[model samples]
Target: MPVFFRKIISPSLSPNTESDDVWEAVRAFLKPRSWQRGSAIDEIEHWFKDYYDASAAVSFDSGRSALYAILEAFGIGLGDDVLVQAFTCVAVPNSIRWAGATPVYVDIDKRFNIDPKDLEKKITKQSKAIIVQHTFGIPAAMDAILTIARKHNLIVIEDCAHSLGATYHNRTVGSLGDAAFFSFGRDKVLSSVWGGMAIISQKSPPKADQPMAEKVKSPPAGEAGQKLRQIQEKLPYPSRIWIVQQLFHPIAFAVILPLYNLIIGKVILECLKRLGLLSKPVNDQELRGEKPLFMPRRYPNALARLLMRQLVKLKRYTIKRRRTVAYYQEVFQSRNEIIMPKSIPGGVYLRFPILVQNQEEVMMRAKRAGILLGNWYTSVIDPVQVNRENVGYIAGSCPKAEIYARHIINLPTLISEDEARRVVAMV
Candidate 1:
C-alpha cells in the first residue's frame, strides 16, 4: 500500500513494483466492490475490539462525528464544559461545542500534552469531561492525568487522532480512558482518507445499570450500544459525489506533484480545488468553528476497505517510525539551537517535532532548499488557518501553548530512511 501511495503521488519515483500489486490496488482504488455498508465495517469493529481489548467499537464518518456520538452517549451537554489542551486541532473543541458544551482551553507542558496543573485549575462544577489528546502519538502523562480525573470525577476521552497502537505505561491508550476516539483521516496515524471509530473501555465498565456495548456478530445489547446504533441509523451514507471527490485525491496528486516544479502542477491543483474535485483536510467553515453539512455522517464501507489494507502494514510502519526517531535523536543530541522532544519506548513519533529559535526562517530555508516540511499547529489552533476568537481561545490563556506554536517545527517520520536522512541534512 505504501508503494502504491508513492507511485500515485508521483511517477518520478523509481518504478520498483517488487512488493506491490500496483494494478490490483489501482483497480480496488478506482472501483471498490462495495460502496454500501457491508461486513467490512463489522470486521473493522471486531478488529478494534480485539486489538484494544475493548467491549464495543462504533464507526463514524469522521473522528469529530465519533466524538460527538461519545459525548451524546455520556449525556454531556448544555451546561457542561470539556477541558482540552490548546496546542491541538480545531476539531477537538468543535466536537465539544457541537455537543452543546463549552471547551475550556488549558496550557500544555514541555511534552506538548496538557499540563495537569492547568487541567486541575480549569475544573469547575460544570466541567464534565477532560479530552486528553496524545499529541504526535506521544503518550501524555497518563498516570498524572488519570489521578486528576478521578479526583474531579471527570471522564477522560483519549483523542487518539495521532495515536493508534500507542501505549501509556504498558497499556494501549484507547483502552486506558473511559472512552476514546481514533481518526483515520488522510494524514493521521492511519489513513482511510476519511474515517474514525469510538471505542468504549471494558477494563472499567460502568455500573450494571449503565450502558454496555457488547454484541459480537449482531447489534450491541445495552443502553450504550442501542444509543450509538440509533445514532448511526439516523445518519446517511456519504453521498456518492463526495465519495468520488475523495477518490479523485490520489489521481489528482499523481499528476500534480511530479509537475509541481515546472509550474503546471500548481495550476492544475488550484483548478481542481476550485472545481470541487479535491477537498482540503479542513474546509473554510471548519476554521470558523462551524460544522460542514456534509459531515457527522456514517462511515462508508469503501473507506473501511482502505483502512483494512493499512492495518496490514501497521507493524512495519511502527517499527520504521521508531527507527527513524532513534536516528533523529542520535544526530540531534549535539545540537544546541533546537530543543528536541522527549523520546520514549512506547511513543510513536507520527511526525517528530523540535523547538527552533525562528520557525518562519527555518521553514523558508527548507522551502528554498526544495524540501517541504510539516507545519502542524503553526498557531495554537493549527495550520495558521484557524480564527482563535471564533473557537473561544483567548490569546494569553495558554502561554506555553502559544510559545510552542511559534517555535516548533516537525520532521516527517513516515518516509523512507533515505528520505529521512535527506530531510535531516537539509534541516
Candidate 2:
C-alpha cells in the first residue's frame, strides 16, 4: 500500500534570506528611475566577476539564454555538437539547440556529474564544446574533464546553475572552465526570481548577428509570478498542498507527473497571465522545431537590485546549507538502504540526493510525513516524458544515467533541524 502525505513540509517553501532587507530594496526601487537604466546591473556583473575571478561577467534574463549566448559567441552552430550530461535539466540541451547546435548526451558518475571517461568516448569530429554541469552543487572532476577537453581542443563551458558557491580543489567553479553560466531562478542557491550571469575567462568573441528583440514589453511577468508564489508559500502547508493537488487529476501519481505540468499547469499559468499577473511557470516540455535563436537579453534592473541585496547574505546561506548537509550525513551514514554520494572536497551541498530502491514509495512516505522531498532530474533528460528524439537523447545509450534517474530522491536542506530529524525518522 502507498502512504499518502496530507501535510507538506517543503524546502521549496524555505524563506529567502534577509526578507525585510529585500522588501525594503524592492520598495525603494518602486519608481522606474530606480531600476531602469541604473547602475545595479553593472554592479552585479562586477560582483560576480570579482567573486569568481573571471575576466568578464555578463548578465541575462535566464541561464539558458546565457548559455545560448556563449555558444553563439563561440560560433558553435549547425553541424557542431556540444557534449552534455544526460542526467540534467532540459534547458541544458535546449540551449544547445537554440544555438543551432546538436547536444550529444553523456553519462553521469556517482556524483551526478558528467563522467569524463564516457565524455571522451562521445567526442566526434563535429564536437566543438563540452558543457560540464556541476550537478546539485557537486563539482565535476574538473581535472579529468579539462584534460579531455584540451586533448580534443574543445571549448569547456561550465554549467554553474547548480553550483554558484561551489568550488573544485580550492578554485571557484566558474573560473575553472573557459566560460561558465549561473542561474538565479527561484529554486537555485541564489534566487532573484529569474536571472542569469555568464562569466568569461578567455578573450571575448566578436558580436554575432542580433535578433530583433521580442516586443512583450510589459513588466516581466515571470518576476511578478515569483513574488506571488513566494506569498503563497506563507500559507499553511496543508493549504499549499491542497491548492497544488486541486490542479492535478486525482490519479495524477499513477500517470506521468510532467504530463500534468505540460497540459493542466500550462493552462493555469496562461490564466494567471490574463489576470495581469506575470507568472512564467517552469514548463516540462522538451524544446522542438526551429525557434528564433537570439542574443541574450539584458538582466532586468529590478531583479538585479534584489539579487544585490541577496548577495550580501550569500556566505551565511552557504554556511547554513552546509550545516544542514552535515546533519543529514551524520544521521544517514549507517543506513544500508539509502545510498548517499561521497562528500566532494569544496562542494557546497544543495539538495542532499540519495539513491534508493522504490523511490516513488519513499517520496510518498516522505510527503505523508509532511516532508517535501525534492524530485530533481527524475529522468535522464529530466521530466522524462518529453520527446527524446527532439533533444538527441537515445533512450538506451546511457545505462547508468537511466538507472540513477529511476532511484534518486533528494532531501531538502532548507528545512529546520527538528523537521530534518522527523524526515529521517519517517524515511
Candidate 3:
C-alpha cells in the first residue's frame, strides 16, 4: 500500500543478509581507531577489488561524488564536453556539469545506451569524455563504446548505477570501462542504501599525479554524519530496512534537506566544511550549479551500509529477475507494437523493457492491475536543434527504446514467478 510506482523500489527488500564472514569483518571494523587504521575502508576496497576485479576501488560519500571525483582525477574540466545520453537520471548531466565541464546530449541505441554510430559523429576537438550508462540494469554496448573511445582518445566513464552484477560479453559492466561508478541506492541492483563505489580500470589510475583516495579522518569532524555512519557500521543487513528506506527519502528531500538549505547549508551539505547529518556533496562548485542535491543523507547511508552486507545474495536475486523477464519475453515476443529485449548469456535482466503502441494507455491499465512501469529513458540527449530536426528520427531512432519508453511497463521482476505471470496477463 505504499504508493506503488509513485514509491521508488527499495533495494533493501531483496533477500540480502550479512554472512558470518562479513559479520566478522564488521566486528573488526568497529574496533577503536578503526577509521585511522583504514581497516574499514580497506575492507570495502578489497570487496570491490574482488567482486569487480578492478585494480583499485574508492568509496565516496555517495555515487554522484564518485562520478565527479573520477572526472576531476582525469583532468576533465571547463571547455571540455562529455557526450551523455539525454534520457538518464539528472545525475548524469549533473556529474558532467559538476566537474567544471558541459554535457553534450546524444541519442541512444535501442538498448538504452549510447548509440555507437551517434557517438562517433559527436566527437570533436573539445570532446573529452564519453559517459556510457547501463540504463535500467541493461548493459550498454561496451564493445562499440570502447572502440569509439579508443579512436578518439576520449576518457570513458561507465555509469553502472543500474547494473551492478550485470555483464556484457562475459565481462562485468564495472570492469569494462576506463573508470566506472556503482550506486548502492534504494532502487539499484545492489543496495548499499545510499553509498557508491568507483572502480579504476586495471590498466591504470585516473592520472599519474593524484593518489587514489584521501584517507577519511576519524572522529569525523561532522558529528551527525559520523554518528549515522557508526550506526550503519554496526547494524546487520535486513529486508525490513526497505520499509524505512522507502518511507524516508521523500521526507528527507521535503523536510530535512530544506532545513540544511536555510542555514550553514552550503558548508554542511555541499562543502562538508562541517558535516551536519548529511552526506557530502561533490564540491563547493556543485552548490553553485543549477541542479539539485546529488548526495545521500542520514537514512540512506545507514540503510545502504547495511545493504552492502546483503550483496552476498546478489546471484540469487539476479536469477529471480531473469526468470521473471524470461516469462514476459515469451508473452510479448511476437507482439508487433512491443519489443521485449533478449537477455544475452552474460547479461542479467535489471528491468525487462517492452515496447508498445499506446504507452500512456498501457501504463494506465498496468497501474490499475497493480503493475508498475518505467520510461527506461524519456528521450535521447541530442541537442535542441538536432532534437527538433530529428524529431522524426527520434521517433524511430531507438524504436525499441522509444517503444519500450512509450509503452514499456516495468513490472516488479522483484516478486515471484506467479506475479510475473499475472503481470503479463494484465498487460
Candidate 4:
C-alpha cells in the first residue's frame, strides 16, 4: 500500500505558511474590493527597494518576467548573449530567450555556482551580461564573477530566486550584481503563491533605513527611472480571475495538507488541478521554451499584500534556513556516502544539496517514508522534462551540472532538527 503523506518539504508548497496567511487569502478571495486593485503594489516595491539596497524595484508577474524586463531595460536582444550557468531553472533561460538574447551556458563549482573559469572561457564579444544565480540560496563566487564581468564590461544580473534574505561577504545577493530579480513563488524563499520583482542597482540606493515616503514616491532619476517606468507601462495588469485562482492555493492546501495521503488528498488535489484552480509552478509551454500566454504582466496588488505578510517574517525564516543547513552539515560531516557542499559564510542555504548514488532510490524511499525530499534541477535545465535543444542546453556541455542532476537531492531547511534527523536517516 502507498504510504500516507505526512509532510512535504518541497519549496513548491507552503509548508511554512501560517494560519493567518491562509485566512488572509480567504479574505482576499471573498472580498474582491480588497484585491481587485490597491496600493499594495507600491508598498511592496518600496519594501524590495529597501531590502535589495536597490535604486528601483519593479514588480512583475513572475521572476522570469522581472528578468525579461531587466534584459529589455538594458536593450539586450538579437545577437546579444547573456552568460548563465547550467543546472538552473528553465525560467532563467526562458527569460533570456524572451528578450531575444542567447543564454551561453557555464559550469558550476563545488558551491553549486557558476565557475568563474568556465565563465571567462565562454565569453565572447556578444556577451552583454552575466546572470549569476545564487543557486539554492548559496551565493555564487561574486568576487570572481564581478571581476570577470568588469574585465569584459558586462552587466551582472543576479538571479536571486532562491537566495532572498541570503547574503555574501556581508552584502545581500541582489545588491552584489548590476541588477537582480526575485521570485515570491510558492517554492521560493517567500510565497505569495505567484509573484516576482526586479531590482536595478545601477546607482546607490537610498540609505539602509530610508523612510518609506522617500523610497516609494521617489524613483531613481535619469536612465534607470525611465527604464523602470517603461517596463511598468508595458506590463499588463494581472487578470482578476487568475488572481483569485492563485489565492485559492493557500485555501485549498489549508484543508488538503492535513488530509493529503496517497489516496484522498492526492485525488482532490488532482481534481482541483484538472479544474484549473491550482496553477502549476511551471507551465508546460515553459518546458518547451515557449512563453506562457498570460505572462509579461505586472504582479497583482492582492498578491503583494500576501508577500508583505511574508516579508514580516523574513528574518525568522533566514535563521531557520541557515540553521537547518548547519544541522545537515554537522550530521553529514562523518558520513562517507554523500558529498556535502562546501561551507561558506553568509549563504542562506535554501536547500542543503548532497550528491549520492542511486538518487532515484533515495527519493523513492523518502517518499514512502512520508518525507518529500526535493529534487531541484533534476535535469541540466530543470524538471527533467524540458526540451534541451529548445532551451539551448547542448548535451555534454556542462558535465558537472549533468552529474549533479543525476545524484543531487536537496534536504529541506524549514524543518526542525529533530524532523531533520528523520530526513537525514532516510539518506
Highest lDDT: which candidate? Answer: 4
Q: Which predicted model would earn the best TM-score? A: 4
lDDT by residue (281-351, candidate 1, tens digit) is 78889899997887789988776766777787778777877898899999999999879877766887777
- For each candidate, the alpha-carbon lDDT, in order, equals 0.76, 0.69, 0.57, 0.83
Report, for all candidates in order, the number of backbone clashes. 0, 2, 8, 1
Question: Poorest 10 consecutive residues of model 4 by lDDT?
Answer: 213-222
**Which candidate would rank higher by lDDT, 3 or 4?**
4
TM-score of each candidate?
Answer: 0.89, 0.79, 0.68, 0.93
- State in Å the error of residue 371, model 3: 2.4
Clashing pairs in 4: 11-187
Write the number of the candidate with greater TM-score, choosing between 2 and 3.
2
What's the C-alpha lDDT at position 55 in model 4? 72
lDDT of 3 by residue, 89-115 (tens): 555676677677877767667776678
| lDDT, candidate 4, 256-323, per-residue tens | 76666546776888899999989888899999999988788888878988888888888898899888
The regions of model 3 sitting more than 4 angstroms off are: 1-41, 205-304, 379-405
